[model samples]
Target: MEEKIKDVLDAYTFQTTRVCRGRGAFICDTDQGMKIVKAYHRSPQRLEFEQLVKYTIRDRGYYYVDQLLPNKEGQYLNNNKDGQMYTVRDWFEGRECDVKNAADVLAAVRQLAVLHMLMRRCDLSEDRVEQFSFQDTRQIFLKRRKELRAIYSYIRQKKQWNDFEKLYMQLYSDCMQEADAALSELNQFDFDGLRKKALDERTLCHGDFNYHQVILNRKYTAVVNFDKMHYDIQVKDLYQFLRKVLEKNNWDSSLGTMIMDTYLSVRTLSEEERRVLYAMLTFPEKFWKISNRYYNSRKSWISSVNYDKLCRFKKTEGQRQDFLNIFKYAFIF
Candidate 1:
């Protein structure tokens, strides 16, 4: 596999004596600094769209994103063996953001604010916008609710319950109660209107803004892996980043406030936007994940440890609620 990919790399005009695998891609030390290569199946049109987005971002004076390198043919994509398409980008010399670090968490929040503003300025055509616009928050919530109901009964019917199942049914019974309240709170507003506003803003979110996507260079922070970049409410990135960090921090209120304040300093969160953000934060995403994975798994038996780990969310329920209560009034009251 390395040799084949190396052959593809050789096609590039750059001379490369060595090729080695790193993480999900290859890291090649080239005359033009170090470059990272990744191969995946993507539509030519999508690649073209990505190129324009990259150019706009770079042109707008935001140069932190990884630069995509064209192949020897002067094209952004290379069709190699197995019909795999490959593209290389300058490797970023930085460390992934440590969510546990308050400084790193706050820095990423500030970066997200700046990115949201920059993405709002990108001018994409109607056709290009239509291709990747996934405004399905309502449908997603509805689907999760359905899954929860099914999973609830599936667990209840088990004759002999394991410790994990018994605990899941116990604590998650309260966790299950949250779903209705959150949804009811959500139903009080015109969510569609907020969605339309987000669409009109033409905002782009990192889509996946976890710790790995955050890169901390000497004095600069860079974000990578834009494969899922899409147009939506700018706050989507904030909500996504905050949820992950809050979980890691055991929903520490002070840390969350500092992170939120950092972002608010850059991008003022309006009342309506705050409401939307609150809705996103309150949704039981982890609940859906546990249910979906358990229901989907076909293995006759599973590790008790794994099931126990899943039940650990129960212990953290207080922390999650406390986290939400800290900012609930920003939207609710």
Candidate 2:
């Protein structure tokens, strides 16, 4: 390791023995055990809130969360020479959850349900309250719908179209209809009331609960990356995990049902929450993601991968719609 990194590690209580590079961080085998050291860019207050969430969950008996360990100075952050912030967090020695594995997918969602159950009614301090506020899905849906239209317009006006743009334009109408339908469904509900309920109940969600962030091992499945934890309707996590897994499975309705049953076995969802989840599933998130990527990046040269994603997305649309229809009829009804 570089001397600057060594200096930062020295501030920690543990003596670093082996240090290796990680995804945007360093993985260190320390005297205390395995720990990950990474540069943190969020505010100290957010860091504190994250730590608090982990500590609370751990105390509540979920020991598999990623924790931001305090340094020798009783602080979770340390500044390097160039003024970059760094943090040492406990690391899990395991592979990421395999979405293709049926058993792993079920287990991952089960654990998420457990985590959500424990994350309920968290008693936040005065300072943490402002930072740990509820997320309004209505505003989120509106913003995404607006972006979808904007991207469609941007792609339509292009003088010459790449393969990716050509495919996007071909499917833009259907995809935009999906977006509008989801937004319309959302408008039928008391969304603000649901957000208020989430706040009143102090429910917490793993804001980015995809399979990538889930870690699996022999004993227990560990969830890493609590950086995105926030106060929101917990079903948001379920929707994220379910969407990713279903997309990979060609939106298999049976598999989707099993995932929902596994989650519901642990924690139940309210009627409004269920409706919100349906709306979320209806949104053309993958289409929006591809469009956003195309619009934001340099358009002169486009990656073939974008074209590939659009093809796969197009191929899966029928199955996806079937899954959504079944979900609404079977679960939401």
Candidate 3:
């Protein structure tokens, strides 16, 4: 850890005596102030891309985020040493919104709506904007299903598992199969057809909007992590936000419906958008599969932890079935 920090800021003075460690980086509280130092194991591409996205969002009139500072060479805190990519950002002092009430949820949605409006009107060039095309999302789902099947097969063949372990293995198998069937139907969807529908209904999307990504201060909402920002179906973002809310509450379908209704009141969805909502419903699962693959691979610490949390979250078969039932009812209508 010391070696990594030195690689980025060799001569930088330290002010504080405390350092906090996270999965990806270290938070140093020194005399120089609070700085978040993130080190990537191999690829700097993602780190560099995230810095650029942060800059773009900040420059485009969103004042909620702390600005990314450049180094002496005018580079955005991206320095590679010993095959590791290191970067730093000024740490802002704030707490995550507990979001305990409907008002908190509604306020967050309103901020997201405002963000979508800004993203739609910004005259940014195509290269500057990053979007997840429908095809790309579908491929992610396919890859995930393959990986989950492999894990389930391995567990089944081991033949030494306990009853709970066996039950979970079967549960995951059934869930993946059900998700695959839903995604298979979604894959047949024509992007060209969706694009036409989108032109009439499209809006700028946060690509990965949810409670975790949103930081609320006393007066304003600050959205971080623009790496997933794209020009895909706007409902994709809304669907993810709702899904997170439901998942956090142990698959409370009533809460999900209330949140969706509140959002719809502010930004009405067209009939065509309603049809595409089914496709959007499956997108989160697509991401879930990607996460599962990373976990199953057991390559990185962060991925492993995420995968464990995901498995734990989806442990209850009855809860997952309830979610699916609600999903089918909401979108298949």
Clashes of each: 0, 0, 4
Which regions in candidate 3 have their CA more than 4 angstroms from the true location?
Answer: 1-35, 40-60, 78-85, 99-106, 121-135, 152-161, 172-177, 184-189, 195-208, 228-231, 266-332
RMSD of 3: 5.9
* C-alpha RMSD by candidate, in order: 2.0, 1.7, 5.9
Candidate 2 lDDT tens digits, 157-180: 878888898898899889878888
> Model 3 misses residue 198 by how many Å?
6.9
Q: Candidate 1 — worst ten consecutive residues by lDDT sum?
A: 299-308
After TM-score superposition, the amount by which residue 202's alpha carbon in candidate 2 deviates from its true location, in angstroms, is 1.3
- Of the two candidates 2 and 3, the one with more favorable TM-score, higher being better, is 2
Taking all chains together, each candidate's TM-score versus the true structure is: 0.93, 0.95, 0.66
Residue 100 local lDDT, model 2 = 86
Per-residue CA lDDT of model 1 for 13-90, tens digit only, reads 777656678778887877777777888577888777777788888889998887788877788786666778788887
Task: Give lDDT tens digits, candidate 3, residues 90-112.
Answer: 66455554556666777777777
Lowest lDDT sum, 10 consecutive residues, model 2, at 126-135
Number of the top lDDT candidate = 2
lDDT for predicted candidate 3 compared with the true structure: 0.59
